[model samples]
Target: MNAEPADQIRLLEVQALDSRIAQLDHKRSTLPEHAELERLGADHAQLRDLLVAAQTEESDTAREQTKAEQDVDQVRQRAVRDQQRLDSGALGAKDLENVQRELASLARRQSDLEDVVLDVMERREAAQQRAAELAERVAAVQSETAAAEARKAEALEAIDAEGFRVAKEREVLAAAVPDELIKLYDKLRGQGGGVGAARLYQKRCEGCRLELNITELNEVRAAPANQVVRCENCRRILVRTADSGL
Candidate 1:
């Protein structure tokens, strides 16, 4: 493919722009904010699960406390009724003794139930504290995730803007070259590790960073200025300059 020397030089500019675009894409993918956001998201999920568990525990414990208090109140009420009957002087000695014994039993029951209520209340308090702590953790993680998302968005926007600019420059550069030459360059670029053209400087193929043998250098020297030459080693379009040492 014979392209004007000027058009061939434009291929190098297009290659530069393409390379920058590729770099920007890579930067967009590997941004640190992405990794941070992923980590924060996982942490947020785990904290939410823990918060749910703590809330369930607190609720269950609170119910247990309520039931214990109700039990105590029921036993106290029975004791109160028995004492009132004994005080009414309507009972015989045997009946009064039975009433007093029943009241004593009720008092013990009430005491035991009160103890249970206290224990359950303590447990409920602890569970409530745990729930609060978990909720705080979830909130913190949510904040971090939001910040990370914002940072990721900002970075992506910048990268995309720059990539768009570089692509536009590539388009303009590509348009200046003949269609046939552009096709050839595109095909080579697709297969040449993203480099379709490279400069031949000091008898070296810049694409492969390999110096040409004497015979290869001589053939390139004999080629006309407008004749397109390819690197024997890497098969990339080799653009010659004054310093090519050919």
Candidate 2:
């Protein structure tokens, strides 16, 4: 980051470029698609569970319907048998009345059970429809997840390549800088929030993007070339430049 005595400011340009590249990488890694894929996965899992639950309910309802149908058949058979017995005069009048009453009760009970079966069937049908809709939705989300993952992977790969290139550049530049000055900058950078130097653009401190104070700017201008000047606003090492990007 520096030379014998006055080259500390020379590294400010590379530092600014590095900061910009790092900012771009941060933005790339935080794309919406990354989080979106996770949400899609969670939704798909829930839909699959919902589908399984719907199928289970359908099975249970079918069993209940079969049992209800068999119960109705049994009641009908018993009523027919009792009617035949009454016709054969195997029972007295009072007994016939009791059997008829019992038959009427079974008919009402069978009617109630059939109604319940119908309700359960309707519920199962609705659940089946819901499950089908969920299945389609899950498939659609899976497609979206694939596309998002591709985009995210491409972005990460590009950033990784760019980072490698920049890291190589940093290594080259760091070697050219004096060991003592580089060590000094590294120490200051650790204490200065990982930014050891920043450029002066117009009358502002580029490190904090703030306007420099009149006193501070005058002091920096009067400072010797070999001397270090720090920004009062951001506490970052300030490097005066002939040209600074806005």
Candidate 3:
């Protein structure tokens, strides 16, 4: 498709803006804050799971401690009743012997129960400490996540603002080119790695970064000044300039 030479040059401007917009989009997607946020999110989830497990352990151990204490109390209460019976002098000799033996058994049971209580209490304390540590970790991860999110937002805002500006400039440039020319350029850009036009500087097609052959250079040199030229290698609209080295 043929466009005025000046119009062809405008295509380069539009292409530059498009390239800038593409770069901005890339920057937005690959922001360091995005990766950091992802890592923080994972850490937060793991910490939350640990906290839940710790809390469950704490609760279970607490229940065990409560039961142990209750057992100790029950055994002590039985011993107290036996002692009161002995003090009352209300039992025969054999009955008194049986009561004293029962009190001794109760004392052994009470000691065993107290040991169980102590063990459970230790477990509960450990669980509580683990839960506290996990909670602190969760809080730290949450703080980092929040900060990363804020940084990500700031980066996106900056990228979007620049993208908007470049897009606006592209709109003006695209309006200057004829419809058919713009259509061809757009199609080429889609298939040509985001470049639809390039400057022919020093006999090179800047789009493909390849120098044109002698025959191609001669053809371009002979082409009318107002006619549009394309690079034989990259098939992009080749904009000529004084430095094209025709």
Candidate 4:
């Protein structure tokens, strides 16, 4: 906290820069752009869930449909051979009985195949519904992504200009400070939220807003004019002016 009047001025500039940066950061985080980002995130999650459900339904339907088609084809082929055998009239009694048994087996296979096909159709219908919902969600998220990007661009363009201007002034002020003092100020300022410098206002440490005791004030007063004095209360470097000398 032992810093010159010049260095304290620099510290004030740094503090100002820090304040501006803090405001810009807050504005950036709380921008309308961030709201859409949140909405986009939610939409992204919901779409992912819907996509999973659709994929599951589609996969199940495909499996069931394939099995049903294969079953139906096998059964129809057997049914055709059975009918040919019955039409040929070259079958003995045992052959006719075997043909009838084969026909009965084919009929039962066809019934099972029909049931599987019905279930697959239902699954496909549900999958289509979910797919449509997912598509809409994806589209909405995509739009939100676009809008948020635009909003970010606008916010950055608007706020960064002023921040850069103040930052340049801060740099100018910092150049006036000695390197070792700048380092010390940076170290302490970080701990005090950019308040490394305090004015001796009404015999008080403005940084901590606490009045200095008589002994400390006397000690500070005895210091040389160019010498740096630190506040005992908040450990902030103090700058005394003639109008409000401590």
| All candidates: TM-score | 0.93, 0.77, 0.95, 0.72
- Candidate 4 per-residue lDDT, tens place, 4-25, comes to 5666666666766767777887
Task: Give the Å shift of residue 14 in candidate 4.
Answer: 5.2
lDDT per residue for candidate 3 within 108-211, as digits (tens), equals: 99999999999999999999999999999899899888888888998899998898888988898899889999999999999899998899999999999999
lDDT of 2 by residue, 1-51 (tens): 223333665577457556766776777868887789889899888888987
Best by TM-score: 3
Judged by TM-score relative to the true structure, which candidate is superior, 3 or 4?
A: 3
lDDT of each: 0.90, 0.76, 0.92, 0.79
Model 1 misplaced stretches (Cα beyond 4 Å):
none
Which candidate, 3 or 4, has the higher lDDT? Answer: 3
Instruction: Please report the candidate that would top lDDT against the real structure.
Output: 3
Candidate 4 at 188: error in angstroms?
4.7
Q: Where does candidate 4 stray beyond 4 Å?
A: 1-14, 22-46, 49-53, 174-193, 218-227, 241-246
Q: Is candidate 2 or candidate 4 better by TM-score?
A: 2
- Please rank every candidate by TM-score, starting with the best: 3, 1, 2, 4
- The TM-score between candidate 1 and the true structure equals 0.93
lDDT, candidate 1, 87-205, per-residue tens: 99999999999999998889888888988988998999999999999998898888888888989899899998888888888888888889998899889999998899999989999
* Structure candidate 2, residue pairs in collision: none
Model 4, residue 23: C-alpha shift (Å): 4.8
Error of 2 at 17 (Å): 3.8
